[model samples]
Target: MTLRIRSLLEQVPDRLDQERFETWLETSALRIERILSRGHATPAGEWYDQPRDEWVALLQGAARLAIEGQPEELDLAPGDAVLLPAHCRHRVSWTDPDQVSIWLALHFASDGTPQPGP
Candidate 1:
C-alpha cells in the first residue's frame, strides 16, 4: 500500500452544526482522534465515564473542561493538554464561540499506558 501525507489543519469545514470527530488512527488498544468544536459543551448534569484513559490537547482556539470533584474548571488555550485516567468523570464546559476549536485526543486501555503497535 502507498503511504499518504496529509495536513491536520487543512480542509476544515466552514460550518460546525455539531461537534465533529475524525478518527486518525487506531490499534487494538489505542485510538487517536481529531475533534472540532464550535461553542459546544456537554449537557448539564451529564458526565463522561469512560473505561479507558484519555489524553487531550487543544491545538487551536480555546475550551473549558470540568472534572468531577474538582472545584475549578480547566481553561484550555492553544497548546494546553490534560490526561484523564480511566473512569475519571469529566465534561466540556465550553468552547470558543467565535472560532472553531481544534483538539487532538488519544484514547488508550485502562492501564494508562500505550500499548505498542504490531
Candidate 2:
C-alpha cells in the first residue's frame, strides 16, 4: 500500500463562505477531522448535542466555545484543548476573522452515561 503524507496547514482555501470540515480518518469507534474556520460561529440559540465524546484542539488562530449552563464562554488559543462528553450542549461562539483557525478534532465512542460540565 502507498503511504500518503500531507500537512494539516496546507490546501486552505483563499476565501471561505462557511467553515470547512475534512475527515482525515475514521473507524468503527473513532474519527479524526481537520476543521478550518474564519469569522464563523454557531447560529444564535443553536447547540450541538453529540452522541460521541469529542476532544478538540486549537492548532492555530483563536476561538471561543460556549457550553450550555456555563456562565461564560471558554476562550481558546493555539495549543489549547477541550474535551466534551456525549450529550453536552455546546457551540462555537467565535472564530478569528483575520486568520484561519485550525482545529484538530477527535470524536470517539462513549458509554451511554452523559458527563457533567465544568
Counted clashes in each candidate structure: 0, 0
What candidate 1 gets wrong by more than 4 Å, as runs, is: 110-118
Where does candidate 2 clash, by residue pair? none
Model 1 residue pairs with clashes: none
The most accurate candidate by lDDT is: 2
**Lowest lDDT block of 10, candidate 2:** 109-118
What lDDT does model 2 reach? Answer: 0.94
Candidate 1 CA-lDDT value:
0.91
- Evaluate residue 49 in candidate 2 and report its C-alpha lDDT on the 0 to 100 scale: 98
> Over 4 Å off in model 2, which ranges?
111-118
Q: What value does the lDDT take at residue 83 in candidate 2?
A: 92
